[model samples]
Target chain A: MTEKIARFFAENRPATPCLVVDLDVVARNYDRLSGALPDAKIYYAVKANPAPEILRLLTGLGSSFDTASVPEIEDCLAAGATPDRISYGNTIKKAADIRRAYELGVRLFAFDSEAELEKIAANAPGSRVFCRILTSGEGADWPLSRKFGCDPEMARDLLLRAAALDVVPYGVSFHVGSQQRDLAQWDAALSTTAAIFRDLEEKGVALRMVNMGGGFPTRYRTDVPGTDEYGFAIDEALRRHFGNRIPETIVEPGRGMVGDAGIIQSEVVLISRKSANDLRRWVYLDIGKFGGLAETMDEAIQYPIETERDGGPAEPVILAGPTCDSADVLYERAEYRLPVDLRIGDRVAIRATGAYTTSYSAVNFNGFAPLQAYYI
Target chain B: MTEKIARFFAENRPATPCLVVDLDVVARNYDRLSGALPDAKIYYAVKANPAPEILRLLTGLGSSFDTASVPEIEDCLAAGATPDRISYGNTIKKAADIRRAYELGVRLFAFDSEAELEKIAANAPGSRVFCRILTSGEGADWPLSRKFGCDPEMARDLLLRAAALDVVPYGVSFHVGSQQRDLAQWDAALSTTAAIFRDLEEKGVALRMVNMGGGFPTRYRTDVPGTDEYGFAIDEALRRHFGNRIPETIVEPGRGMVGDAGIIQSEVVLISRKSANDLRRWVYLDIGKFGGLAETMDEAIQYPIETERDGGPAEPVILAGPTCDSADVLYERAEYRLPVDLRIGDRVAIRATGAYTTSYSAVNFNGFAPLQAYYI
Candidate 1:
């Protein structure tokens, strides 16, 4: 919708349906989160749109990464992020994957099982580990406690075993779910985690870190509170737990840090009437679901479409992707004004697709070429 | 979730995820439909999942394809399918895309615009065409009639204009919609289209082809009927319209023809609890939203997930993907039994992820590799 974005078309390089991120917005987000929680460490959730540019930008802002896969680990390394700055937060990893992370000099690893601890002890005895605690007041979107986390009692067992084995169990971590709406849920998860830490300390394992997993929602749907509030609450809770001597903390915000900071723009390919009520509008966007927007089924993200660069006003239109599925629609109730005389070949912008918008949900259904990403 | 599918993982060979069509069931489906509609044309929508093997199989079974993209054109061509056998059914036009389809000898082009016709006329002189009529069926999950079909008046004008262009314009095509549930609504669309055909013939345009565009639903939910009744009924209605003298009738059955023929076998890696009630289990076996089963989101396709190698039934567990999104769940309120003490390493099988599955939705997120395609 901006002149600079429109100018991308005049370049005549690629076709419709691609993603572009404004680095300025990303830097602003990093600064906001880091500024709010000065004592806590920030680690970008690389799984959320891990473009090389994005990784480089976050690292440049002095943030580390939370990577789950070997490829993601490789991405952080290639982006010049030191291995110590990266947290291999995923449990149930392959031995080879763990070995790869160790080879990369990643000192902080998140773990759950006795088997995993044995694997790490055999592979890298120098690793400083985190024993994950299942501490939701029972409301985290990820009943992570049930599937992945060690029960508080079980966690004490694991940490005590690690201490005896001479493996430095430095931290305790738990995620309060992604897109969290209730601030009290986060506050409760932290409070419960602190109890687990104190209990572990009493059992002769002194904790050096508290890894508060990322679930800070972004400023998208008003149903959930904004990112700034998440930062402030997290800061306040960290003080309660560590009491001015806050151990190093890692906050991995995926969608919250970048969801609103980016937009996906596309071009209208055809506008026709399907029947009396359904006005079928197809945009030959550079960004297809596989390349850009892939969440087209069950739940669709918002596409606040803007027709004109200069708002003559707004129009409501149900925009669908070029994919064949009827569910390929990006918006059903979405209304943005098109120039009443909107024609074919006109371009439009679908806002708020930056986080988990493209790479997170994208799947190449038609074998279309992957979308090209650019930083403005 | 039978052991028949779990064998796929025992011998792990990496390949892209693709639609695996059962030649036996495919032939049966064709015979079944052909038995019902003795005189109708079967045009497969290649955009569903255009693996070359599937394409060749359908063509061998005597079914044509409904293509929407240039790569699809190339796919049909690679299968040795004649240009006459393939119809470019996309109603939108990017001049280059249209020209590619036209240059590839695509005679039957679906147009929703006078401007599109003009472009085809200028670029593809004397190209055979069809003016798609927009439908108003509320039965379709996505009513394509809204986006790429000409209204009755515009349809008439386009027919007249085609007559003036000194080119060949065939009969009309209207896609009732994708995932259509109601038969009466399609009957209305068909009868309306039939009336328009009569009007076009009276105007002396000499209509010949009647393309009832794809929207036949294949049953995913057990509560709905999954028979070929809708396909049979649509054909029967068309029979009543022109009696024994109908034009070359065409209908594209995308999901219905291929959705349930294959299975995606995944393995349960981590089983965790989300809340006290919901289990947050991440089965990092292999299948993902990109591999095709991700479509039925609100209502996930209840695929029978089984253990590898005929292992004895284990306890019932909830399944999910390795992707960190709280929403990345595969089954909804369904139970899956694993090998009693299912651990970090185990395999699970998911049935009926063939149509609109795989071959499209792949993103290099985390380190999860793309799917591997194995055809028998």
Candidate 2:
């Protein structure tokens, strides 16, 4: 889609290097994801964009929270999300963090290893546990094949071990990986999960909540689905997997929830020649791969950077970050056409960067100013 | 080189997740580069590791400072590098930042575009400018080439423009990109710079410095040179470019100075399996891309991640991050056989991360805590 990014830029608060959150886009995203997984529960991943305003928007959209650490849990709590409505998805927790989360009444916790099971048993004594069965896919952005998923054989055995330790295994939770472009991977992985569930049922293991976790797609381009956005396949999978029997599917989409909602409204800092005598020069904006690609050096979930004039056709130019690092690329090479005569301080917005753009990326390694936040 | 990285874990400071800056290595780096370019000044690029301790060490080792922005300028100034010794490398600057630097008496500055020249002329008319000629090479781990650099042909014109604007073109500066591995590219680019300097000198553009800006190599490996133990091509290039030249030949080595000086020492938190039957399980660590590979994600700078326990022969394992984001990877299929039975809270130190780890990475992303800083 030919997005009017400049207009979105112009409509932001008076912070040059600020992150702009589009409430309307976020609401639409919530509705779309909630509708697609009608039987499932949607927990907005707070880590993506944990600005107080964004959290409030997620709360208003009738979504729960998927918090990882204590700060996330605290942020959700401060944002008025109840303890029961939040699940600590990052199952590996510090001893202090675990006790604090347990104290805060966070029930649903994800676990991948036997050591973690024992820690959970010792910490809370009887906290509700969700064994995180990490999934694998061929085209997965972050292949979950190694992260936190227990092998199906080991997972079953671990479940028995946890049961013996008085650690209640709520259900199985597996992420097909973030930004999953291929939908069939989800189908096959879910089929594998389903088999595990059936085996657990036969063995009389408490198999209750099958968290066909969140990796649902959000369209970055009109032509294809992003790494996270599975397009129609995920919706169809939801329909096929639980045709008659409904399961409590918990999805924590860090990028999908606020990815489209946020945009980095920045100025054209330096417009200079990329090479000697190249036809066009680059439009260096205040935000670079370090800022807009805050959570990512590679995976930037944004609509292409396109600028507009008052009454002229849009021109796309290669937009980049302020860092001197060459790898600090924002929009890929010549992907976006921008106004050729773009001057310094000319405002442009990098759309769909609301998620994982600000909080996730604030180290200021180059000692540049940290990104200020604003909500629209 | 078989680097004993376990020493970093036992460095006796900070929490499980911490950055250990080995002062000894940093001093040697500063000494080697300074000794090689004895006649020309060496500006320690503050963007590499802006931590106060790192800055103190570099400044203590008799190196000038190269700053990109105001905070960096302030950092250099605070480190007592003096404004005259600090060169504002960022060509794009607002009137305020320029005025601040000029007021602080920053001696040298760079401008890539004519617009920036005009602005510099209007704001800091008395300041001398460096005509940054764009060099062609693509292997910068942190590529600054994409943003900075003017066409050599147009740069010739810009040199004349500087003459007209009364901004002294004290020297010509061109970077061969960061993490530049190709020595031949430097040879060609410096030869091109020398040619441009000669042409400019023929055109009555007198110069005092030919800033062969730093992209010197430094890694955990010994065969590549410029690692912890040996100096790389810094002296060879100086000999070729400025042999017996009366003018100062400048080199601003950020990564080269500290890339091997610091190591990201983190403790393993948990290890989990992907599927029930999968033999592989993930070992999650306290430090992640946010703290280490925060800036360079897609083309992440590969470092040697080693465990501290010196037991039997080393074995390689996939170390994952604590963040829930799948793309948050610490290593790409890294293998270092230190110990087979690595457990939770086992310390792992990632060498060659000193340059960008603390400087570019942010804390509070994904609600994870930031790495505590410690220096020897």
Candidate 3:
């Protein structure tokens, strides 16, 4: 935990199951990403955690925004981001929402299908649009499904078709996947993107941009390569694929920008074993899947946990949220271990939870309030 | 769809991605369940959809509540439910919350472990507590893991311990599972509960209540047995095991009581295929998993969908929510089919969503507001 966060916790003693984000850490993360990829423009993915404070911080850093909905566009604008600095990034958008974004002075948009392209063309006339292409999503912990993108051939056709419409055939885009570990996955995706770009150029479209949608990693249970390594690899891939000319590049870092900047403090509500011979004790926390840690679904994003009894002997424990629903379990097979002396009411710090925690929290699922968040 | 809900939708024409609940349907469902098992008192599981209207209606109908948290208890009280009609049902709870519930005059509680029972004993002194025994969770569409309940041996020990504490050692409780289909599962669970009761009686503590937790099915994509069938089976199981000494029984029905009473009308945002040869069209709805169809995780609860053009030729489609997150896909492997003529801006009604939809909705995951609900 950052010294700022520790000081905040020690002083305020906020309620348990709350997230505390250090704004200084967020600023440092922004600078690190900018320094790592000097040529790429950073568009902070606002859906990660659209706290007004984070948005204002990124906006002050001259970071562009990749928004998922019209409300997000309004949030960015409210945070002092100009409409020109925002990109409507979600491909599945209502026609009315597209029109609203257009009316709000946002021009750049994303599309993965002909239907979406048509919506943008009809509603946000003359807007710059990028066609998202499908990736294998091979090396990411939370691999995205085929729900968002289309195939390369379809992307090429859609971009070519865009030229015939009122909207500009701006570029091609693809997400390797979230928390992407294998840097080579970027190389593979860029290769397909370069092919699409070349094909579009041959058809006289000449796409001018390449949006390598966010797949940047953040520290979790295991160590990950720093932003510098990812930047070097992506720069090398661009050089290898695009040869002499790289298009205007953009990186939308949601998790990487703010994930490690925050911590969630949860109280151990109960700790007990199911039976006399049960080896694993079930440790119930005040926060859970519905509470905020939705990323822990399927034991995917294992957040590093720390308790007051840390540095003492620990044992394997099945962690769960204090909800009556069975699916509210955070981790059962991930073998999360906690200190043996961890008592009920002991505070547990869940690390790297800033990105998806607060925004994904349910609205009082089991009468538990949404995960409270405080920005320092 | 119920005539009431359909008429409301036609007359009101509320905005897209809203849930419309038929209060009459809810009342009828309550009447049906009560008629089916006159011996068992109904405790509406408040977590399913804790709208104040539903709570008030149930309260007026003399329904008790099975609450999961202190806020739920507050909600019940606000809806005119007497404190005596509320039970603190979640096994994992903070000591402070226990004290709050006790202070609020809640006398009944459920626990699965010694730690939880002790908390109840210490905080809610002289309260009635029931120990939840683990069930196989077989023949359930949403089979619960070993997250909420304990083994039969551990439950007996806990109840025995409860008797020694300040809390009353009420009888046993067990959940066959959510959306349970097998009547024999209740029989198996009751056999274990009877053994625990008899063992406790021999130890000079005669348990007085058997809290059979909710497992009652609700109609989803396919038809389920009516409440009469479930009530009859449970009654038979109680008779076979208790042998004329069926204690004060309680049935906590969440989905079974309200699942079929609501319909979610969502707009089709976009419809497209990945490639020219891709057989399955991807149908994007304005409402997604985060928008409140969270039960569709892993395609477990397939809500039957109806569209304006339902009578037209139908084709297999992959349904997804209109979010940038790829996990928002609702039904991919479940072979969901939509009308071929289903167009963008068309309204689609997801049936039997009254129970888990609105309550499970994220506060605003993708800048989309929580599923708007209208109780009529």
Candidate 4:
């Protein structure tokens, strides 16, 4: 367990099943990434954790934002971020929302389809637009499906269309995937990105920026290299692929930037044996899939969990969240081991949960309160 | 589209991606169930759609509640329901929450483990307590996992232990499953329930009630029986199992009680071909899994969808929610056919969504607003 988590519990005595984000850890995580990739501009994806305190801290550190909707843009602005520093990154948005973003002085946007492009042209005229090329979401913890970007050929046509429609064709972006583990995936995505740049150039549209979308990895149940290693590999790939023609680059890091800064303390509600002969114990927690742990779906991103019990023989236990719904199980197939002597009221600390917990939690499933977040 | 949905859009012009609940339909549904199951007590499961308006409507119909938490009990009370009319039905609850419920004058509770039984014994003396026995969760649209109940032997011990601790052992309960389709599953579950009753009688503890947990089905993509069929089958099963020794019976219906009463109207954001050669179209809607359609997970509970366009050739399209996250895809593998002429800004009506939509929505993921609920 991280010292910040232990200290927070020791000092604050906050409610169980609550998320605690240590600002000191967040600042340190930000510093590590910024120091390693000194040249690459960082746009913190506001959707990851849109808590006002997190936005304010990132904004104080001179970080720009990658906003998904108008409310996100408003949130960043409320946290003291200027509209110029925010890019409307979501490809699927309503025309009215686009017009509102433009009215709020936001200029940069991203689109992957003809309808969205037309809407953007009609609503946010003369805005800097980025056309995303689809990337194979291989080897990422949360592999995104074919939902965000278009193929390279379609991307070329869309960028050219953007230029003709009075919107500036500013950049090309592609997310390898969220919580992407394999660095080679970035190499492949960057190659596709380079091909998009070439095809746009052949069409007589010169792009000014290349957005390296938010697929940067976080350390979660896997051997992920530190930020420096990711920085070195990303820097080497850009140098190899783009050579001297590299455009102004931007990197959006959602989980990698904020994940390690937060930890969740959940209370154990019950530990019952399924049957007389059942081997594994069922451990129920006060928090669950609906209570801000939705990322635990399909066991894709297993948050490292630690309980207060120690010096006891351990056994595999199926962990679950406190909900009447049947699908609220969190760790059943995934091999989660806990102390056999662990009893009700014991707290389990889930590490690296800062990015997606509160943002993804259901409003009030089963009449349980939303996951309360605390910042230290 | 249903006449209620069309009338809602025509007269109210409610916001897109919003859930519109017709109180008239809800009243009809309540009347049908209460009229059919005149002998069985109906406790409206508050987690289904905890809107105050719906609560008031149900309360006016003289419906009691099956609440999962303290806030749900409070919601029922605020809607003019008396404290004695609410049952604390969640198997997993905190000790403080149990005490608070007792303080609120809630007498009926459910438990599945020794720890929880002890908690209830300490918190609420002489309260009506029920023990849940595990069920197979087979043949249900939304099958529950092994999270809430204990084995028959364990349950027998728990009820006896409750009697010893001065807590009233009110009865035994078991859920066939949520959205349970096959009536045979109830037969098997009732057989198990009878065995538990026999076991409790052998221990000299006469139970006063039999809580038949909610699994009543709603008509979605698949056909479900009317309330009369379910009522007749349940009555036959109880008569066959317990004969004249049957106790006061309770039925808690969440989805079955309210699913068909509400419809969600969502706007199509974009319809794009994934590739030039790809046959299936990708249709993006303004509301998605995060926006309260979370029941779409794994395509388990399929809500019948209708669009504005007709008289056109139908094509299979992968339906997705409008979010940056790729997991928001609703039905990629499942067959969902839409009119080929469907365009952006076209509205689609998701029928029978009153139960799980608004209560299951994320607060604001990716800056998208929570699914707004409008009462008609």
Candidate 3 local lDDT, B117-143, one digit each (tens): 999999999999999988889999984
Clashing pairs in 3: none
| Candidate 2 stretches greater than 4 Å from native | A1-13, A22-36, A57-62, A134-153, A179-186, A223-243, A310-316, B1-13, B22-25, B56-62, B136-146, B179-186, B224-246, B273-281, B295-300
Query: Could you report the DockQ of all the candidates, in the order they appear?
Result: 0.30, 0.51, 0.87, 0.73
> Is candidate 2 or 3 superior in DockQ?
3
lDDT of 2 by residue, A49-107 (tens): 78888788778777899887889999988988889998888867766677788899887
lDDT of 4 by residue, B1-376 (tens): 4576678789988888888888888888888887878888989989999999999999999898999889999999999999999999998888899999999999999998888888898889989899988898888888588887888888888888887997999888889889988888778878887887888889898887888888888899878888999888888998999998877999998888888888888998888875566789889999899999999988888888898786679999899998888899898888989998998889888889999888788988998878898877
Candidate 1 lDDT tens digits, A141-164:
323324456666666677777887
Q: Please list the residue runs of candidate 4 whose C-alpha ends up more than 4 Å from where it truly belongs after superposition.
A: A1-5, B1-5
Specify the poorest-scoring 10-residue window by lDDT in model 1 chain B.
Answer: B12-21
Looking at candidate 3, what is the lDDT of residue B248?
A: 92
Q: Residue A173 in model 2: shift from native, Å?
A: 2.2
Task: State the lDDT of candidate 3 residue by residue for A267-300, as single tens digits.
Answer: 9999989899999999999999998999997888
Q: What is the lDDT of residue B6 in candidate 2?
A: 44
Ranking by DockQ: 3, 4, 2, 1
Worst 10 residues of 2 chain A by lDDT: A1-10
Write model 1 residue lDDT over B297-355, tens digit each, in one string: 54434555555545665565556566544455565466555565566555445666667
Predicted complex 4: CAPRI docking category: medium
Per-residue lDDT for A1-376 in model 4, tens only?
Answer: 4676678789888887899888888788789888878887899999899999999999999999999889999999999999999999998888999999999999999998888889999999999999887888888889589988888888888888888897999988989899887888778878888877888788898988989888777787767877888888888888888998877888999898889888999998878775566799889999999999999888888998888786588999999988888899999999988998998888888988998899898888888888899987
Q: What share of the true interface contacts does each candidate keep?
A: 0.31, 0.65, 0.88, 0.71
